[model samples]
Target: MMKVFDEYRALSDDTLKPDQPKAKRFIEAMRKFLDKKENWTFWLPYILTLELCVKCGTCGEACPVYTASGRKEIYHPVYRSEMLRRIWKRYFTLSGKIFRGLAGAKDVTEDDINALAEAVWRCTVCRRCAMVCPLAIDNGLITREIRKIFDAIGIAPDELKENGTRAQIQYGNATKTPTEAFKDTLEFIKEDIEDMKGVSVEIPVDKKGVDYLVINNAGDYIAFMETVMGIVEIMNYVNADWTLNTPDTGVNDVVNYGLFYSDAELVAVAKAQLETIRKLKPKVVVIGECGHAYDSFILYKKLYKEMYGEEMPFKLTHIVALIDRWIREGKLKVDKNKNPEPVTFHDSCKWGRCAGVYEEPRRVLKAVCKDFREMYPNREMNYCCGGGSGFAIMFKDEFLKFRMETYGRIKAEQIKATGASVVATMCANCKGQFREIIKYFNLPVRYAGVSELVANALVYK
Candidate 1:
């Protein structure tokens, strides 16, 4: 058996060779694209905007990988951005060519390719850096463009290549689980809900005329089945006319990991969900506890509009916000006594930071948990769990350890200080990562999704 270090080493070494035909083509394409002086119109805005960056290193301090890696030179935010900046300078600025050394312009050699590949791909694109940056430079967008440049040359990381291809070819979702399996997973959740809550929840799959269609990430179906059950329970309890589209139901393919650049591929994924909504002619679309799903839908709404020639017909809502609305409207009632433990909430990167969804989850938690305490840097400033952007599946051991040692360290300490026995988060990804980190640290705190807590606290009369 290959050791863990050996496995990662082998995977890292799989980067395309400089002399490879595909690599040559990619470099040529990138060179041509960059060389187009007219293209400077598009590039200048970002460069000019970035020039205002004060380099206060606030973003550097906010990065989970940088913190976990002990602020290594290669993991620094400026280091990766500088790599792209140097290349941009060489191609776009005349001074860079005449005084390349002074301008920090360096040729994109094989080592640079490998280093760029490794460095950019390591980020979860959690946007914690952008949240802290004074200029809001959006390093995540920079990383995405870098991935696009690398992908044009067929040099994406193995995990990205495998997952992206699977999403495109298999179930049309990144998890690659078949539609039948997805249906079965829903059936299993229905059964579990029946057993746990004595409620028969009907999760409509592709049911037409529903008011809303909920899109769930496959990870929630498989590992966090309770969350799926909780969603169904709540929808059923409130008599909300919602359906799950099992046929191409897995639509959370933000694949922001940088493997896909074609707008066509992204639209294809977005359209699958929209098609379901269109067929059902739902009044709105409610994206479930998954943050990236909302980001894919709301933040990148233009992709769908460009593809289909109009905006998504229905409104889009994050599940937490929907729950909060329902609670405030008296559509749902919860008994906080069931969740008497003191609790704290972890803000999900996609929900809290990227999408600016801060208070909804807290509202849901405050209603469900008797005692709720805030993490030190809560909301948009919360640390990433280090296992996002497909890192949970790709870099299992290292990412999990990183979560425990860094992101979860402060969270765990906060939970301990609060004397809370549970930690709740609205995002399925955060719930998944926290479960692992809490178990690894043997912390007495239990982790639950805000929906799960609400489901348990339902006061049905």
Candidate 2:
């Protein structure tokens, strides 16, 4: 049950020797990052995460990665975090310098860095581990910081970098959808929504001074057009003053894969998105169907307030929370019988754990799902979809196999146990993860978005 990542296996025999230029560069970057006090602000959570760990294995029991690995020692939540602690102590702490070997501080090396780098990317940053820890130590946050260090040395998962981070910085969206194509996609979605739902709705684009600038995961428009339609249908039904900004992450696609790779990248992508909102001067920014993007916005909004001396001119809210509000307000009459199948909700780590959005999606689900069954350990304590970070998109042979058989297996079993034919998820990644697991495990389950369920349950007057 050991989950072996071939990429890590390939990286283990590292060529970045102590005397090599690459090693020197990597070490320099590591030292600069470790030595800086300003970065302490960025890494305070990681510092708290590393310092607070008591080597208690309680979190390991809760970690899907650790559990799926047959409780492999390397995959334990403590493994990489403890490694970071030792490295930090060795390089940065006085006790480490005075006591050295007695303090368990060892000299940092290329091999040590390589090992930690390899191990960190294997995690999903689901933060479920943190919930179970007595000290509330977050191994997921530690892993993400380690990935940023690895990324500083130009070591990172390519799927997230070339396709995700780089694309977001360059095009304002990770999918690399051109500005014109984005506009066209919106127009197409409006038409498609009208045709499919018999709801002729105007999809606003770049219209300034709206109360809300609603943005969704651009991936939905590209891969799941119906999700876009569902979101628009809800907006039109509510007669909300909203506009879809399709041009960039600044105004449009509200996803930031940089959260998985680098803090700098996360900030850059957020600034672009924030600048777009500022230009539009919307009252509230509603993130649609993408949990992590909302997570990024929540984190970055605070950071922006710190850096810019004032919060942006907009309030931030997730569509799920907004939908729940609408349901409670009787703004949309829902017919739960429209979804006749037994359904269960899967909590996106970002929405439920990271963002504390526990009840909104379920409340929305309950509004539309007749036979909604609760998955064991649902909400804040829920298991990851095995693709929380970005694994669902890594389709390479060995990585894909590890993803499905190792990370995704437990989730697939969880759904199978639910006896629910439809599994509802808010995050696009969660949906993709479940879809993959259903295929791999041959389970009788299909994925549905909360918006999709809402759209289905809409009482068409």
Candidate 3:
């Protein structure tokens, strides 16, 4: 029965505690990160967002963070959004320069930045707030900008910057999963596919001149190998000229944790993935069931134009889209009877809000599952899994408890209300989040990829 404000205040001890000796350094770095002239010149969207927000309270009701925290006033979207907007006005506005006090401007401190930094992490950057706002103020974008400012000051979670962005940029993937591991996993998947459907097909790798080059999170090879097998089965059934790169090739996975932490790191990691695509020269890049990866590739196209002065060398398509295309073409057939159990879909924030992909995964699910229940307030209006940012991976004890108890609890209740034995999602992060919730809360539900459900219903040719 702890209030959300109290729960968040507890996080302040750890998350908002600035290094007192380096307070000046943090302030300086924060300003530099927000510097309009050099580091970040694209400020018009941010400007419109800041000037546009009217604080009408529509966004508060729309936000999952606010609702999920049992209507916590701290998680209210306007709280952090207004803080950044005021900070911008205080330093960057002409009105503030002439009449600071009249303009409601104040000199912000290191402590202020620390509190805002923690607030940024509290949000999942789900963009639900903007969807309902009359002014189209994206608090999610504002939250990310705050995170970038923190990242510049060396104040972000180490899991995202170190274990995720740096690890992937320096060595290819977050785990640096071995080439042999990829090969071995594919071999096992092929055998499993044969055993299940009496079908056998070669898993393509490092092959040149294919129509598509697909990549997934390396975690798939470790735990959800069935999803990988699903992909291979559908690819074979569609007669796709697709390939998976060797792990040594440094682009086998398509995740960029930098999307959560900073723009610079997102650009660097995405450029690396694009380089591999350039080498392979595929017509399109298929990003497998990871929501952020779809978003990263979309961002990459813009970054590529800015850096290289041209459109990207390849195309990027979500795996859900690819499957939907095949189904529409009558190329990959599925039997709905294969999955008779009740099912529900969780629309990932990146898929619906970030990427405008609402129907593809749902269409596939409907075609494959007999009893597909819709989560209320679904599609672009759907709630977050509470693991959208690094919360799923960054597990400091207090943060873990907050994510489970405060943020993830609402989604659990939604699933339980449906009485669904299985909840399916396209994003690995969503699935991973729910997997933990299933065990920790001892819920009757389990998680599955949308692809896995389709694979279950696949009628092999």
C-alpha lDDT (0 to 100) for residue 439 of candidate 2? 86
lDDT of 1 by residue, 109-225 (tens): 655655565566567778888777877786765666666666666666566555654453455566776778877877888888888778888888877667867766666777777
Cα lDDT of candidate 2 equals 0.78
Task: Give one digit per residue, the lDDT tens place, for model 3 in 179-240.
Answer: 78778888888998898889878788998779988898877777677677788888888889
- Which of the two candidates, 1 or 3, achieves a greater lDDT against the reference? 3
TM-score of candidate 2 relative to the true fold: 0.92
Order of candidate numbers by lDDT, starting with the best = 3, 2, 1
Q: What TM-score do all the candidates reach, one by one? A: 0.87, 0.92, 0.92
Better of 1 and 3 by TM-score: 3
Distance from true position, residue 425, model 2, in Å? Answer: 0.8
Q: Model 2, stretches more than 4 Å misplaced?
A: 1-24, 94-100, 248-251
Compared with the true structure, all predictions reach lDDT values of 0.67, 0.78, 0.78
For model 1, give the RMSD to the true fold.
Answer: 3.7
For residues 1-461, write the lDDT of model 2, one tens digit per residue.
Answer: 12233243322223222223344455566666664474654557766775666686888888887788787788888877877778777767799988987886877666566566667767888888888888877888888877777778877767787778778767767788888888888788788877877888988888788987888887888776667778889999999999888664354678888887787778877787878887888888888898889889888768788667896678889888889999999998899999989999998888888888888888898889999999977888888887778776766536666677666888888888899999988898887787778888888778888898998899977
